[model samples]
Target: MEEKQIIIRGRSYPLFRCHTLIVGSGAAALNCAYHLVSFGVRDILVVTERLGGGVSNNSGSDKQTYYKLSLFGEGQDSVYDMARTLFNGGAMHGDIALIEATLSAQEFYHLAQIGVPFPHNAFGGYVGYKTDHDPKQRATSAGPWTSNQMYQKLLIQVRQQGTEILDGFEVISLLTVGEGEQKRAVGAIAIDKNKASSGLDSLVVFQAENVVLGTGGPGGLYQTSVYPKDHLGSTGVALEAGAAALNLTEWQYGLASIKFRWNVSGTYQQVIPRYISTAADGSDEREFLNESFPSFGKMGTAIFLKGYQWPFDPRKIENYGSSYIDLLVYQETVVKGRRVFLDFRRNPAWKGGAELRFEELESEAYDYLHKSAVLFGTPYERLQKMNPMAIQLYAQHGIDLAQEPLEIAVCAQHCNGGLLGNIWWESNVKHLFPIGEVNGTHGVYRPGGTALNSGQVGGYRAAQYIAECYRESTVTAESFLELAGPALERSVGLAEGALGRVASPNGRIWLEFREELQARMSRMAAHIRDAAQIERALAEAQAQWEAIHRFEFRLEDPARLIEYFRDRQLCLTQLAVLHSIHAYLQRQGGSRGSYLVVDPQGSASLEQLGPEWRFRPENAELRQWVLQYQFDSRTHHTAWEAVRPVPEDHFWFENVWRSYVNKEVFRDSADSR
Candidate 1:
C-alpha cells in the first residue's frame, strides 16, 4: 500500500489506501468488516455518515423479530421449505431465496454467539413465533431492539479486530475502471460531514481492491417514511455507476406514528385501538373504521390482525384481514382529505350503539387478547397491560401515546428492491458488493426480521468470496488514479458548476427542491399508483432534476455541497422508481406485494369509496417475470429487462447425481481418479 494525498482549496486531503472499503456503519457493514478481518484481510476501512445512526440501530417496534428457519422445531421443518416459502412470494429469484434460506440458521446463531440475546426456553430450545408472509413459526426476537443489539455486538467485534472506521465521512461516488467484463470497482470519493459543516474543504479518497455497500435504503427520498430522516444511502451512487436495480417498484408501506416515525405495529395494533378521523383543524370527528367495516367486531378483529399483517396489500383488502385497515386509512386520509388517529382511550363502539363483546371477535383475535391478559379494558389500558414499553418508547421521542391519540398514516417502511446482486452479493460492477438493505435480496413480500438476517448473510457471503477470490489481486495506486480520473473530473465539474450558479439571485436552495421532490413522490409513487399519475410524476421529476442543476451553492457551506449531491442522487433514484412503475403499468403488471395499481372500471365499493380505493389485479402470467431497470451510460438512457424464469429441476435424487457429476460430492476421490 502507498500513501496518496490531494490538495484542495489550499488544504491537503489524504487519500487513504486499503485492501477493502466498507460503506456504512450499520450491522451489515460492521459484520462484513469483522468477517473480513477474521479471514486475514487487513487495511479495512468502514466509512459512514454517522456511527450507530442507520435504520438497524435506530428503528424498532414491539418485539422486533429476526426471521430464520426453526433451529429446534419438529424434524419435518427444513431449509427447502423456507426457500419455497420465500420464492413463492413472487418477483423473487429461486436461487437467491435458496441461498439465503440455507444460510439463515448459521447467521442467526452467529449473531447470538456474538452476544445477541435471543430468548431460549427452559428446555434449552430457542422459542419462535410466526411473522408476515411466513408459513412457519421461524421468527424470534431480542425484544424490540433486535437489530440494534446485533449492531452493537458486531461493532464491538469489528473494533476488536483492529478495523479502522471513518465516521461522518459520507461516500459520494464509486470509482470504477475499464469497460464491460473488464470493468471493476477500485475505490470511492467521500466528504467529511463535520468538517464540511464547519466550513472546511475536507475530502477523503479511498482506494481499495474491494468495496462493500451496506448503506441501507433510500429513506430520505420519501416524505412519509419510517426510515430515519438522515439515512442517505448509496443506491443512487451505485445506479449512477451503471449498476442494475431489481424490482424498484416493490416496497413495504404500513401505518406508523406520524410524530415519532416508529411503526405502531404488533401489540400496539393487537389491542384494537379506536380509529378516529378528523379535520386538520381538529373538527368533524368520526370513527372512520366503523364507516369502512360492516361491523364493530370485524373492524376490531382487523386491528388485532394488524399485529402481523402490517404492510398494506390489495390482495388482503376483501380477505377479512387487518391489511384492509391500511387501505381504509389511506382512503380516509389521503383520498378523502381527512386526518386519521389511533385513539386508545376507549373501546370501539358499534354503529347501533352496542357495547363491544369479546365473543363477537374472531377466534384468533380473541385468543391472542385473552392470552395477553388484555381482554377487558379500553385499548389504552390493554396496551399498557400488554406492552408498557410501547408507550414509554414513544414518550422518549417526545410523544406521549398514552395521553394523546397517536396520529397515523401509511408510510414507507422498507424497500424490498435495490442494487441487483448474485449469491456472493457482488453487483454488476466487479469488486463492488452491496449488502443489507442496499442488496435487492427480498422480492415482493418478506417475513418480518428477514432484512436483518439478509444483511448478516450478505455480509458473510461477500467477506468469504472476497477473501477466497481476490486477496492476492493487486490494486496499485497508479491503476486506481488512472481509473478514478474520469469520475473525479465529473464530481469536481458538478461542484464547480453548482458554485458558479450560486451567484444568481433567483437560484433555488437544495432544501426547497428536496421538499418538492419528496412531496411529488409521496403523491404519486409511494403507496398508490396510477399510469397517468406515475408518468406525470416521471416528467415532473425529470424537470425538477434539471432545475436542480441550476441551483446555486455557497462554497463555504460544505453541508450544502453534501445536500446538493445527496439530492441529485435521490432525484435519480426517484426517477428510476417512477419509470419502473410506469413501465409495469404499461405492461399490465398488476398489484402484487406493496404495489397497488388503481382499477379503471372502479370495481371496489368499500362503503361506496371513490375511484382511488378501487384496485385491479394483474394478469396471472406476469407473476412469472421480474422487471429489471438498468441505466445505460453509453446512450444516457434507461433500459428495462424482463427476467423470465428458467426451468428448475429440484428432485432430491437428481440434485445428488448432479453434484456427483460436477465432482462436488466426494471431490477428493474424484480428483484423485
Candidate 2:
C-alpha cells in the first residue's frame, strides 16, 4: 500500500492506495475479503461505519434458516432442481438463480468447516426443514443466531488474513473514470467520523483498482424496519454514480416486535398468541383475529401456518394462509389508526364472549401442539415448551414475553431488489461489485435464508472475478488522481455548502424528514401499492429531497453531518423505489411476490377489501418482468426487462460432464479438444 497527500481547501488529506476497497463490514464484505486473500490477492481495505454493525450480526428470529440444497434427505436432490425452485420463486433471472443454487452447497459446507454449528443428526447428516416458498426441506439453522455465527467466524478469518479495516469512515461518493461503456471504478471518497467529531476535518481518499459494496440494505429508509437503525446501505451512492438497480419495487415485509426490533415469526407465531388491537388510550381492546377469521380454528390454523409463511403474499390470502393475518393487522393499524399487540398470557375471546379453547383448533394446529406437548397451557407456556430459548432471547433484550404483551406491527424486513449485477456480483459499472442485501439478487419473493446464501455465493464469485482480472499493479497514481479529481471536487463543494447554510425556522430536521419519508413509504409501498399512491409518493419524495438542501446543520457535530448525508441517500433510495413501483403499475403488473398491487373492487372480507385486494387471475400474466432504474445527470429513467429463462445447457448432465471434463478427465480440455 502507498499513501499520497492531497490538499483540499487548505487542508491536507491522505490518499491510500489498495488493490481492492470493500465498503461494508458484514458477512458479505468479510467473506469477500477472506476469499480475496485465499486467492493470493493482497492490499485489500474494508471501510465501514462500525465493525459488526450490519443486520447479519444484529438481527434474527427464532431459528433463522440458511437455505441450500438438501445434503441429507429421503430422495435425491440436484443443484438443477434447486435452481428451478429459485428461478420460479418470484421474478428473478434464471442465470443468477442457477449461479446461487450451484454454489449454495459448497458455501454451506465451507461455512460449516470454518465454524458454523449447523445442527447434525446422530449419523452425522445435516438436519433440514421447510421454509417459505421452498418445495423441499432445504432450510437449516443453528438456532436464531445463524447469521451472527457466520459473521463472527468470517470476521476472524478476515482478521487472520490481515485485511486492513478503517472503521468509522463513511464512504460518501464513488469515483469513476471514462464515459458510458468505458467507465470504471477508480476509488472512493470517505469521511472519518472520529476526526470530524474532534473538530478536525479528515477526508481520506482510497485509490483502488476495485470497490466492493456489501453495505447491507437501506434499513434507515423505513420508519418500520427489522434492519439495524444505522445500516445505511450504499445503494443510493451507486445509483447516483450511474449503476443500474433492478426490481426496486420488490421487498419483503413481515410482523416484528417494535421494542426489540426482532422478527416475530417461527416460534413466535407457531405458538398461537392472541392478536389484540387497542385504541390510543389502551381501552376498547378487541380480539382482532376473531373478527377477521370465520372461526377460532381458522385463526389458529393461520397462526400455525405463519411459522412457514412469514412474508406477506397475495395468493396466501385466498388460500386461508397466514399472510392474510398480516393484511388484517395492517388494516387495523394503518387503515383504522389503532395499535396492535400479541398477548400470550391467555386465549383470545370469541365473537359471542366465549373463551377460545385449545380443543376448538383444527387438526393440523392441534396435532402440532399435541406433538410438541404444549397443548394444555397458555401461549407463553407453549412457547417455553416448544423453544425455551425464544422466551429467553427476548428476556435478554429487556422484553419479558411471558409477563407482557409484545408490541408488534408489519414492518419492512428485506429489500428483494438493489444494485443490479450479473452472476459475478459485479455492477454495471466496471470494477464496482455489490454483494449481500445491497445487491438485488432476489427477485419478488425469496425463500427464507436465501439472502444469507446469496451473500456468500456473491462474495465468492466477486472475489474470484477480481482476483483473476484486477490487481494492485493495474491501478496507477495518475489514473486514480484523474478519476478522483471531479468526485473530490464535488464532495468538497457539498460539504462546504452544508457548513454555510443558514438555519431556517421552517426548515425540517433530518429526523422530521426521515419520519415523514418512512410514514409515506410504509403506507404506499410496503405491502400495498397503487399507481395514484405511488405517483404521490414520488412527488413527495422529490419535494423532500429538494427541501433537504435548505436545512442547516452544526458544522462542529460530525454525527449530525453523517445523518445529513444519510438522509440524502435514504431519500434517493425512496425515490427509486417509488419510480420502480410506478413503472410496474403502469405496465398493469398485478400483485406478485412481496409486491401487492391492490384491486379495489373484487373482494369479500375486510382483509380483501379496500386497497389490499388482488387483481383477478384472468387479467394477470404467469411470467414476470423485472423493473430497472438508472439515474443520470439530468433525469431518472426506469424500464421493464423480461426475466431470462434458464439456458438448455444448464441441465444436470451438461453441468456434470463439463465439471468432469474440466477437472478430472481432460486437463486443459479447451485447447486439447
Separate clash counts for every candidate: 0, 0
Give the Å error, residue 179, model 2: 1.5
* Winning candidate number (TM-score): 2
Per-residue lDDT tens digits for candidate 2, residues 367-431, read 87778888767788888888888888899989887788998889899998899887678887888
* The best candidate in terms of lDDT: 2
For 344-441, candidate 1 gives per-residue lDDT tens digits of 88777877476567788989899888887778978878888888878778878787766788899899999998888876788878889999999887
Which clashing pairs does model 1 show?
A: none
User: How does candidate 1 fare on TM-score?
Assistant: 0.93
TM-score of each: 0.93, 0.93
**Candidate 1, which ten residues in sequence have the lowest lDDT sum?**
664-673
